[model samples]
Target: MANKNHSDGDLKGTFYLVMALGVFIVVVWGLCFGLFLDRF
Candidate 1:
């Protein structure tokens, strides 16, 4: 039972980590795109 709980916690942490990375990538992409548009 303890091992199962640890696995679940790891999975939740991994999911949140992935989500934060995805959001960071998206925000950076949008900022770059906006900067490119400003040049036109």
Candidate 2:
């Protein structure tokens, strides 16, 4: 039971990590895209 709980926590941590990374990437991409548009 303890091991299962630990694994569940690990899974949740991994999910949050992936979500944060995805948001970061999207924000960066949007900034770059906006700058690119400004050039025109």
Candidate 3:
């Protein structure tokens, strides 16, 4: 039971980290794309 709880916590943390990273990548990509459009 204790191990199961510990693993659940780890999975939750990993999920949040992946989500944050995905959002960061999307924002950066959008900014770069906007800049490219403005330049061209």
Candidate 3 TM-score, true structure as reference: 0.73
Off by over 4 Å in 1: 1-7
Tens-digit per-residue lDDT, 1-40, candidate 1:
9999999988998899999999999999999999999996
* Superposed Cα deviation of residue 15, candidate 2 (Å): 0.4
lDDT of 3 by residue, 1-40 (tens): 9999999988998899999999999999999999999995
Report backbone clashes per prediction: 0, 0, 0
Output the worst ten-in-a-row residue range by lDDT, candidate 2: 5-14
- Model 2: per-residue Cα lDDT over 1-40, one tens digit each: 9999999988998899999999999999999999999997
TM-score, every prediction: 0.73, 0.73, 0.73
